[model samples]
Target: MVSITISAAKRTSLAKDLPATLNFPDKTVDTLTVSDVKSAFAAKYPQFYPSRQKISLKGDNKLLADEATLASVGLTDGAELAVKDLGAQISWTTVFVIEYIGPLVVHPLMYHFPSVFYRTTVEHSLLQKYVYAMVMLHFLKREYESLFVHRYSHGTMPFAYVFRNSFHYHVLGGVALAYAAYSPTYANTSSYIVGTIRDDPKFLMGGALVWLWAEVSNLKTHVTLRDLRPAGTKTRAIPYGYGFNKITCPNYFFEIVGWLVVCVMTGSYAAWFFLITGTYMMALWAMKKHRNYKKEFGKAYPKRNIMIPFIW
Candidate 1:
């Protein structure tokens, strides 16, 4: 058996209550994993659950992987480690449900109860009806994927992020887009008149085709990612196959395409705003993931654009 020393970082509020040094009594350098250390720490300090702890070597900035054996990471009999509190945590599933359910519910409410959102109500146009169906279908697919298809590496995220995410999906993407598409002003617009853009069969059919393709392609990309890490494990592997070949985040690319289709179909400034903001956020995420893949896999990682196929 080996004794490993763990010290809590001073940045956390719980640091005062944490012991200056914690010794693992039942673990050996070769046999123990970072996850085992976190479990032991949680047993001693209940507030610092494994999900809320970030552990690393004392002088190293890189976090230790839970699945990596201590020996593999160069930890020995007298090695020292640092632990940081990740603050309050909420389940990833819970956060996703909260974020997506808002758009699902809010959009329908605005579409069906126009009086609540606007002073005057107009008869729903065929274009508005098509947009409504697409919106519901898109969000429902998201809910299904979040619940069943996507497998998260980390079980929880910072609780503070829930509100920010919800506001984006609920208020902006849902309510704002719904109002812009279904409002009386939308019905009165010349482009949406009975013989104009909205009435053109080609425009409606083309938009629907693109939206459908994007949605299906996005689902495929997500499934590709989900299959990379087997169920009930946090292990990550460099992804390959369709969509992965050309873009680091084809899921984001397809998602942006789906939203762009909606924006063009609705001709709503609000929809454009949603698409732009969402694309920017997804781009940031794609760039970060692309860099991480390069760092983690080095030369073994394939070359790919962050999101767009070859243009980016």
Candidate 2:
């Protein structure tokens, strides 16, 4: 038997015995999979189940797979597994949908919802749906994109983050944007074609064009990045295309531009605030990615703007 030391980042009821120490049959005699370890773990400590536990090497970001052997992951007689109670695990796509779908469904409802549900009567004009369409496009695109486009080294997220992210995106962002834009006072401007360029035509036409263009660019960039990893390899390479020449994160740039157009089209302070806050958050992430790329590629990578072109 091999004795291993397990340290949990957050203490759980499993600590009823002071410290976490367990012994498993030596793999040479008996092969021990992560599943077997988890089963033994659950049997030892009834508080945690195999599904609720996230077992990893100490100080490592990667989580052990169920079928992985104790020895395959480099765990030996004295190796330490930093265990954590993740409560439950969920797919990134599911988490994102739960977070965004509420807003996507609710924001449009606010436009035509009865006053009984909301404090004031919510109504919209002909052009209001343009902004609504943009909003829906943003979230719906995120859902399909997550499912079909994006890939993560770790496909699951912590349980608490799922609920927290849902609350932030749905309750705070979705409901608030809906309430602000669907209020009794929210009105829309009338428009003509190209001649009256400064009116609703400009807002909807320009916004829709920018939104569509940005969406296309973002998808293409994601595809390019995804292809770099290929079918069975984990190698990563720099992505190029669209605004890649000027920014390491062209996807983020397109994302910001897409929402900025929504804000302009809606002409709502709430929309503006959402766009501003979202852009700021994106900027921070972009800068972080920029630094990461520089560190990763070093002199081989370009010295360019992070998110915005020429003005990051």
Candidate 3:
């Protein structure tokens, strides 16, 4: 037999006078599992329900999986196991809905419907209307994908940070787009769209194709990634097809393409700013994801560029 220690937070309902060590068979039993160990505790103490129980080797922050053996997680004769409550858990879908809907719903109102009673005297132009449509379309696509095309396993950011991210996307982005892209003067131009062709046929025809194709590619990449994993498991596979062959994060690549197309069409500082900053952040994230993929998959995964194709 072996003895193990169980620890919990003080002042809780856990029996304070319980002995520090509990006996267990020295030989590995075929039926003995981490879930069984936790179940024994829950049978004795109602507060330690198996679902609510989070056990880990002392000094390690990661929770041990239920299917894992006690010894596999480093439990031994004199080992200490820390038990704590996970408290409450929220689904990623719920969090994503709040994050995407704020910007998608609230930001468009400023561009589409403005009151004469408001303090800002912003007049609309054809370019302004076009920019408004594009911005609305971008955010609507994000909302749709978040709701349908993405599946998260088991990870969470703090609720406070989720609120902050929503504000950053909608409130900050809305003010910038409304102030710059919706200017009244951009539409009063007669510049040649192509090298010699006038009447803005270049952007109307060429840019529309590029922008929409990029958006669709981005959506396809997201759906491909979602199908790689089942509902609530932390398993992933190498992405195949569509955008995965050239770069590690083709979704970010296509998103950058969409923003650059907007800059070409509108020639607005806001569009350029979005393109540059978004590129910088996405590059950082792509590199991070690339490194993480390498670390996780090791020799089994293929080498790929971070965000760009061969140039990167």
Q: 1-312 in candidate 1: lDDT tens per residue?
A: 766677776476655655444566677788889988888888877878998999998877788989888899987887788898888999898899899998788888888888888876677777787788888999999999999999998889999999998988998888788778888765644445577788676888889899999999999989989988999887778989888998899999999999998888777899999999999999899989999999999999988888998888
What does candidate 2's lDDT look like per residue over 1-312, in tens digits? 777677775677655553477777645313677767777778877777776778888888588887787778877776777777877677777787788788888876776674755565544554566767777787888888877777665556777787777865786569878776656544433332123432355556766888899988888887877777765344667777667888888888888788777666666678788778777788888888788778889999987888878887
Q: What is the lDDT of residue 117 in candidate 3?
A: 22
Winner of 2 and 3 under lDDT: 2
Off by over 4 Å in 2: 1-3, 7-10, 14-76, 79-82, 114-123, 188-199, 230-235
Q: What is the Cα-based TM-score of model 3?
A: 0.75
How many angstroms is residue 59 displaced in model 2 relative to the true structure, after the best TM-score fit? 11
Question: For residues 107-129, what per-residue lDDT tens digits would candidate 3 score against the true structure?
Answer: 56665555522444555544455
- Write down the TM-score of every candidate: 0.90, 0.75, 0.75
lDDT of each: 0.85, 0.72, 0.69
Q: Compare the candidates by lDDT and give the number of the best one.
A: 1
Error of 3 at 101 (Å): 1.6
Stretches of candidate 3 exceeding 4 Å from the true structure: 1-55, 62-67, 77-79, 83-89, 116-123, 185-201
Error of 3 at 213 (Å): 0.6
RMSD of each: 2.4, 5.0, 5.0
Best TM-score goes to which candidate? 1
Ranking by TM-score: 1, 2, 3
Q: Candidate 3, residue 291: CA error in Å? A: 1.8
Which residue pairs show backbone clashes in model 1?
none
